[model samples]
Target: MDGKTLVRRTNFTRIIAACAFIFATAASAGPTVKTLRVDVLYWSMNIPGQVAMRKGLEQEAAAINRDADKKNQPRIELTPYIAGDGSAGIERQIAQMFEAVKRKPDIIIVQPTDNAALAAPLRAANQAGIPVVAYDQYISGGTLAAFVTSDNYQAGYLDGEYLAAHFPDSKELKLILVEYPHVSSTVERANGLLDALRDYRQPFRILKTYEAVEPNSGARAGAQMLRDFPATGSVDAVFSVNDGGGLNIVEALANAGRTEIVVASIDGDPKSVDNIRAKRLTHIDAAQFCGPLGAEAMKIAYALATGKKVAPHHLVPVFPITSETLQLYPGWGGPIPPRFAKPWQARVPYWEGTVRPAK
Candidate 1:
């Protein structure tokens, strides 16, 4: 071959080899994903929020993974523990909390069964340098990396407003308040209802504040209360802290052939919406955005787990749902109402810190 042709061939081979070396180095330097282990302790699968939280967590994890793929960041891996229904399950929930802590997961997200029962285990988790994210309900004495929940107090307050505006006409308003004080969320709800009731122009007395936590217990209490006040004319209105208790009250009143009582409550359970649609005694339900609450908790947990700065408290908003307004409401275990538009006003107070000062 000619000398010039030989030189060109040698140069071409050297350039090809250099290109191969560059490609190999680039492939070897590809991004690494940081995987985190997240432990979730659900109070009860029967409760809507608890179950919805699981769904929301999965969604949030997917979003996080997608974003992580784009930015090449960490991905979350969740391990969930569900405690079943009723008062009988409280002990089991506590046991599950301790068990989760022992596993030493990087982050623990909990919907506490009782305000006090889960505190110890949560404290232990914190002591071990594991961040705890409280969802739906707060743990009174634990160190939390973040707290995410519905604006429960606002939920009850909104319910009370709905009842007060459309409250039944009675010589003297006799209201029955169904409450369960073991959890902070319920207590706030009860207080919010009372706060709104206090603004009412009419004279009203709380006939009784029955301690019923869930629907079954609420039903039992409602039945007993009805028996005690069997006259069918006693309670002018009923304010239950959650939808479960409100449903119980409706059932008790219906069986007794009384349709005079107006029921207002929190938790937008699908059954409660159906009752409203059926023109039952239930009047209003303050719908909590449970999916959003769960999603926010997942976000906060991810931030805490990854050593990022986050707010001490993150609150999901709530809105009032009535038979008239039901068509526009969106909540858990139900389809988004017909022409649902985002409730900008409901979100403003929470986002702008206007409501935080009141709490």
Candidate 2:
């Protein structure tokens, strides 16, 4: 061959050999995992369930990143947006979803504030091919890759069942629901509570439904509840959806020097458990496996991001923490206690259970 032609051939051979060496090195290093970008649209962190879910998600993410270096696992980049507190938060959540869609994240994980309000933005996210994984509360109008949440109905059922067993069947038990109806989780809670009362054939009448699910609103509702039922024995029981605002009601009743009302609530908040232990107004508190609920949500999101098939819905079990079952719970970041009670007849499926909480 001529000198210039021979030089060109030599360089081409070297290029092929270098590519082979690179491939061999990569093969020895094991499989490559693609990192995913996830945006989190969280409702108010004021609620204890959201706080625990956040903690659990962070812990699980850290674990995944730590393991990524050693195992064939993907790492995730998380961007968070928090909606402000109370009913005002519902608007903020709706706006945040549209903004999240603009950013074009690999996955959008959300705790929806209002089921119907989110339909527009969530539907937009769907059209864009950005998968979403929702937790705690559901989004109404989208094809969610996965949805993970505690068995909200079961929590309310536990509260209602507890009240049914204790209250006198002779008179209709005066009932109050410290409720917010926009979100599916709380709505299910109220439904479950009422279902339990009916299932047990307990006589009861709903005195009122005070709109409150956070601290400030709860405080107002609590004080108002007392005004409406001035006498000590006027209100038989109160069932607050979650402890975020429910604790405010508890404190309000306590501060007013009232003791006649028997209060039951959903959520496994530390303070709620404390109230139960102290023999206070919040007699029974049904608790969520909050930390684990968050962690499992992360796992589901990760699976979807990595192009793995995940179950569309996963429901974690909730525990009822009374004075007796308090010992079974080890707090939020937990060695989640085994399923404690017999099966509950709920509207939701029997697949209610949780994974280990991220420590």
Q: What is the TM-score of each candidate against the true structure?
A: 0.84, 0.88
Candidate 2: tens digits of C-alpha lDDT, residues 131-218: 9988988888768878888888878888888888787767799898888888889999999999988988899989888988888888
Q: Give the least accurate 10-residue stretch of model 2, judged by summed lDDT.
A: 350-359
Q: Cα lDDT of all candidates, in order?
A: 0.77, 0.84
Residues 1-359 of candidate 1: C-alpha lDDT, one tens digit per residue = 99999999999999999999999998886856668889888877666656776787779888998998788788877888877766657788888888888888889998888888888888898788889998888888878888888788878877766666665435467888888888889999988887776766545898887877677787888888887788867778888888756677778788887788888878888888888888788888887777767777888888888889987886666767777677667667333233343232232233211112123
Would you give me the overall lDDT of model 2? 0.84
Instruction: Go through the candidates in order and give the C-alpha RMSD of each one to the true structure.
Output: 5.8, 4.6
How displaced is residue 123 in candidate 2, in Å? 0.9
Instruction: Show the colliding residue pairs in model 2.
Output: 268-287
TM-score of 1: 0.84
Total backbone collisions, model 1 = 0
